[model samples]
Target chain A: MRYELYYWPTIQGRGEYVRLALEEAEADYIDVARCRNGESKMMAMMNSRRLDTPPFAPPFLKTNKQIIAQVANILFYLGARHNLAPKPEAARLWVHQLQLTIADFVVEIHDTHHPLGSGLYYEDQKPAAKRRSEEFWDSRVPKFIGYFEGLIGHNKGHYVTGRRLTYVDLSLLQIVEGLRYAFPKRMKRFERKAPAIITLHDRVAARPNIRAYLESDRRIPFNEDGIFRHYSALDE
Target chain B: MRYELYYWPTIQGRGEYVRLALEEAEADYIDVARCRNGESKMMAMMNSRRLDTPPFAPPFLKTNKQIIAQVANILFYLGARHNLAPKPEAARLWVHQLQLTIADFVVEIHDTHHPLGSGLYYEDQKPAAKRRSEEFWDSRVPKFIGYFEGLIGHNKGHYVTGRRLTYVDLSLLQIVEGLRYAFPKRMKRFERKAPAIITLHDRVAARPNIRAYLESDRRIPFNEDGIFRHYSALDE
Candidate 1:
C-alpha cells in the first residue's frame, strides 16, 4: 500500500525525515502536504477521527487503516517497511534507541531559537537563543556525538544496523550534515575526534537514494522557518 | 532476569513512565537510582558503552547488556518485552504514533518553566514562563488533549491495546493525572469534556500494582524539578 505523509509543504522540517525513508525504501508514497491544496487536506485529516490512533502534529503518516507520527517513531514504523532494522529482539531495540537519540538532537536544534517558547518569534528571543546555543554546544552536542562515535566503535560496522543501512543511519547522516551546515567551526573541532561518526555520515550521504533525494527539488534548503536555522549566534 | 531502571534518584520526571509500566505489569525490576551511593552507579550505567546503540539522556532501561532510552522508546521496548503493544504490524505502529504524541505533550509541560532555556533558573525566567504557559493552555494543551480524546473515542476498550492494558494507556493516565495536578484550572475546563481519556486514566491508576506504587513513598510526589511542575504565574 502507498503511504501518505502529512507535513508542512515548503520547509523540510520533520517531514523530510519521513520523506527520506519512503524514498529509500522505494515505497509508493504521496507527500500529502506538498500537492495542490494539500495543506487543507492535512487540516481535514487532523480533524478526522477515522482511526484507532492519531498523531498530535504534522509529519504524521498513514497507510491502510493505521496512522503514525513523530519522526523517530515514524522511522521505527517504516523500518519494517524495509529490512532496515535488525530482527532479533535485542537488535530491534537498539535501532529504536538510536532513533530516540536523533529525536533529542532534533529538539536541541529547534530550541536554538525558541529557547524562550516555540510559540514566540525567533527575533523576540535571540538573546536567550544565544545562551541556549552556548549550553547546547558546550555540553550536549559533544556528548551526543561522542556517544554515537562510541556506539560505532563498539558495533564494528559502518551503519547503525551493522552490515545493512538502517533508518537510524540515514537520520544520523541528516543530523551530522545539518550540524555541519549550521555549525561549521564547531563541527570541524568535532569531526576529527569522532572519525567513525563522520565516516558514517559520509557513507550515508553517498547512497543513491539519499543523494538523489538531496539533489532533487524534493529536499528543501535549511531555513529560519525550519529546525536547522543558521543563527550565527548559536555557533561558537 | 530483572530489569534495572536508571534515572535521577527523585522526581517522577521521565522515569515515572517506565516505573508505571513495570508496576502495572508486575515485572521484576529495581529503581537502581535511589539506593545508597547510587549516583555513581546511575552515572556509570548511563555512560556504559555496552549498548549496541547509545542513549542521549536518561530514563533508560537495561536488562543483561541491552539498554533503551527516551520515555516513548522505553515504553515501546517494554511494550514488546511484556507484550504491552499489539503484535500486528498495523497495531504496533499506531501505538508508537500515540506515544510520540505524548512526547510532544511532555515537551510542552517542560517548556512551562524552561521557556528561556534549561540552563537558567525558574526564578530568572518566570516572565517568559508566563507567556509560555499561557500559550500552552490556550493552544497546545487543548489541541493535544482533543487529539487523544478523539483517538480513545475511535477505539473500543479502556486501553489502546484493544481489550488489553497497554503501556500507552498507563502513560496517558499519568499525563491526565499529572496535568490535573499541574494545571488544575485548565484541566478542570477540559477534563470533563473527554470522558474516555478520563476513564482510561482512572483505570490505569486503579490497577493493584500501580495503586500500591502510588501509595508508597517510592512513587515520588510531583515537584518543580519534574515535567508537570506547578507555579501560580504559570496558571491563569
Candidate 2:
C-alpha cells in the first residue's frame, strides 16, 4: 500500500479528516508530500498524468493503484478497506450522507469568515463575513448541528453508523473540537443544547488510537490557514 | 424493490438525479410527497421524519426500510442497485469521489448568487454576489472544469469512468448545461479550453434515456429557484 496523502503540511484543514482515518485504521501511510523540500512533490502529484483519475484538489489519497479524493468519498473508499463503514448498501449511504452533511457544514463554517470569496483576504470581506456569520450563527449552525444531534438520536449508539466507529464520527469529533476552538464563547452557549454531539466528540477523542494520535506529535495544530481560523470579530 | 423519493414539486433541483436513475432502471418507485395538493403531502413527510435520520432538506429517497439523502449518495446507492456504477471496489470509489467533486462544484454555482447566505434574498445579496460571480468566473469555474478535463484526458473514452455512461457522466452533462445556463458568456469562454468535457457532455445528453429525459416534460426548465439561474449581473 503506497498510501500517499497530498495536502497543505502546516495546517489541520479539511485534510485532517483523511489523516485521522489513516491513523485510526493504523494504515501504513506517510504524509509524504508535507516534509522538508516536499512542496514540489505535492505539486507533481497535482500535475501527474499517470493517474487514470486525478483528484480535483487535495487531500487526495493514492495507493499504488487507486487515487481517491473528497474527504467523505475518501473515507467511503477507505471505509471499505478498514471496515470503518457499514456493509449493507443502505447503511453505507447513511454514513456517506452524514459525511456530506459535515462537508456542507464546513462550507458554512468557512463562509462565516470568507463569504465574498476564497481568493480575497478576510479584511477585504470582513463586512460580508460579519453579515454571513450572523445569519450562520442564528440559523445555519444550530440546524446543521441539530441534524447531527438527530443522527445520534436515531443511530442508537455513540457513533453515526449505529454501534460502529466510522470516519464520519471521527470527522464530527474534529468539527466539534474545531468549532470550540474557533467559537469558544458561542459553542459554550449551545453546549447544553448539543449534548449528544459534545459527548460523541468526547468519546471519539478518548478512543485508544485517537487519544494516542492526538497526544502524539503527529497531529498538526490548527492555525490561521485552515478552515477553523480564529477571527475575534467573527467569533462573537 | 420499493423506492419513494421526497422532493419539491415545482422545482427539479437535485431531486432530478434520483429521478433519472429510477427512470433509467425502470424501477418500482413513487415520487412520494409530490401529489395532488403536494405541498401538504411534502409537509406530512417532513413531520413524520420525527426520526434523527430525517433528511436535512428534501430530495431524499427511501428504498423499503432504508432512507438515503444527498443527490450523490442516492445515485451511488442506486448505481449499484441498477448496475450503473463500476463493480470493482476501486472503480466504485473513483466514481463516488467524482460525484462528490461535482457536488462541491454545484454548491459553488449556488454561491455565485447566494454568496452571503442561502437564507437571504438574492436582491439583498446582489452586491456581494456580483463580487462572488467575478471570482467564480475568473478563478473557480475554470479550475473545476479544468480538473474534469484533466480526468477525461487520463482515460481512453470521453466519459469519466471510460466506456460507461455512469452517473458522473449524466451529472457532468447536467453541470455543463447548468453552468452554460447560469454563466453563458463565461462558460462560452470556458468551452474553448475544454473541448473534451464539452464532448462528454454531448455524449451524456445524447444517451438514449437521457435524450428522452431531456425532451420530456419531466425535465423541468432551469428557474430562479433551481441551481442554474440566469441573472445578467452574475454573468460577465
Candidate 3:
C-alpha cells in the first residue's frame, strides 16, 4: 500500500525525518504536496471541517483511515509498522523518547534564525538571531551532541538502541547533516567531542537507500527558507 | 509500584504534565526532586554514566528497571498501564500526536521570555522578549487554541479523543491554568474564542483526583520562573 505524505513542497523541514525512515524501509509512499496541484489537496485535507482530527500544520501522513501529524508521531507509527523501532515495549518508548529530544533540538535550530516567530522574516529578527545563534553554537549544540554521544557510548551496539537502525538513528543523521550545513566551523570543532554521533552519521550516510536518497532529486537542498538556515553573520 | 519522578524542585515546568497524569490516575509516585536532598539525587541521575539509557534531563520517571523521560513518553507509559489513554492503538497515537503539538506550544511559551536562549536571563533578553511575546500573545496563542477548538468541534465526545479522560486532557488543563496565570488579561479576552478548550480545562480541573491535587500542596504555584512567565511589559 502506498502512503500519502503531506508537507511543504520545497523544503525537507520536519518531513525529512519521515522521508528518511520510509526510504530506509523501502516503503511505497507519495510525497503528496510535491505533486502538481497536490498542495491544494493537502490544504483541503487540513482545512476540512468533516475530518475528526485536523492536523495543526503540515507533515501529516495519511495511511488507511488515519491522518497522523507531528514528526515524532509519524516516525513512531512508521517505525512500528516497518520494524524500524525496537521490539520490546520499553525499548520502543525509549526510541520515541529520543525522537522527542531531537524534536526539541530542531525547534531550537529553527529559532536561531527565526527567534521571534515563524511568521516573521529572518531579516526582521536578525539581531536576536545573532545572539541566539551565538548561544546555540557555544552551548546548546555541544550539550545536545554530547548527550547523543553519551547515548551511543552507553549502547553496546553501533546504533542508538544497540545494533538496531531505528528511526531515531535516521533522525540523528538528519541532525548531523543540518548542523554541518548551518554551522560548519562550529560542528567541525564540536565533532571531536561527539565522535560517536559523528560515526553514526557516517554509517547512516553509507546505507544504500540513504546514499541514493542523498544524491537523488528527492533530497532538498538546505536554504534560508528552511529550519537549518546558514546565515554567515549568525554562524560566526 | 512506586514511581520516582525527577524534575526541578520549585516550578511545575514540564514535570507538571507528568505530575497531572500520575495525580489523575492516583498512581503511587514521588516527586523526587522535592524531597529532602532530592535535587542532589536528580542531578546525580542526570550525570550518571552507569545507565544505558540515561535521560538528557529531568522530568524522567523511574519505575522499577525502566527510566522513562519526555513528557509524552512518560504519559504514554502511564496512560497504557492506568487506562488514561484510549483503548485502540490508533486513538492512543492520536492522543500522543495532540500532546506533541502541545509540547511545541510549551516551547514557544518558554521562548517568549527567553528569546535568545535558555542560558540567558529573562531580564537580559527583555527587549527581544517583549517583541517575541507580543507575537505569541497576538498570533501563536490563538492559532494553537483555535486548532484545539476545531478539534473539540470535530470530535463527537467532550474530551480531546472523546468520552475518555486521556493524558492529553490533563495536559490541556495544565495549559489553560498556566496560560491563565501567565497572561491573565489576554487569556480572559482570548477565552471567548476558545470556549471549547476553556470548557475542557474546567472539566479536567473538576475531576475528583485532579481537583484534590490542585487544592493541595502537590500542585505548585505558577511563578516568574517556568514555561509560562508573566511580565507586564511582555503582556502589553
Question: Top model by lDDT, which number?
Answer: 3
Ten consecutive residues with minimal summed lDDT in candidate 3 chain B? Answer: B149-158
Candidate 3, which segments miss by more than 4 Å at Cα? none
Which has the higher DockQ value, candidate number 1 or candidate number 3? 3
Q: For residues B1-236, what per-residue lDDT tens digits would candidate 1 score against the true structure?
A: 99988899879888888899898888899888798877788887667767456567788888777777788877877787787888886777678777777887788789788866676789987877887788787778777777767766676766755688888888888898789888888888887787878888888888888889999998899988898888866767
| Candidate 1 residue lDDT tens string, A1-236 | 88899999888788877888888888899998889999999998777667445567788888787777778877877786587777786777778777777787788788877876677798888877887787788777778788878878887977766778888888888788788878888778878888998899889889898898889988888777888888776776
C-alpha local distance difference test of each model: 0.80, 0.83, 0.90
Task: Give model 2's TM-score versus the native structure.
Answer: 0.94
lDDT string for model 3 (A112-198, tens) is 999888778888988889999989888998888888888888886789888879999999999999988988877788788888998
Full ranking by DockQ: 3, 2, 1
Error of 1 at B180 (Å): 3.1
Supply candidate 2's per-residue lDDT for A5.
84
DockQ, Cα level, model 2: 0.71
Which regions of candidate 2 fall more than 4 Å away from where they truly are? B49-52
Better of 1 and 2 by TM-score: 2
Q: What DockQ does model 3 achieve?
A: 0.88
For candidate 2, write residues A1-236 as lDDT tens digits: 66888888888888899889988999998886677767688888778888677777888887887777888888888887898888876677778888888898998898888888899999999999989988988999889898788778877796866787999999998998898888888888988999999889999999888999999888988777889988888878
* CA displacement after TM-score superposition, residue B87 of candidate 1 (Å): 2.9
Model 2: per-residue Cα lDDT over B1-236, one tens digit each = 67878888767678877777776667788777566666677677666646656677788887767777898888888888787798887888888888888888888888988988989999999999999999988899788888888778878676777877788877788888888888888888779999999989887777787788789877778889987889988886
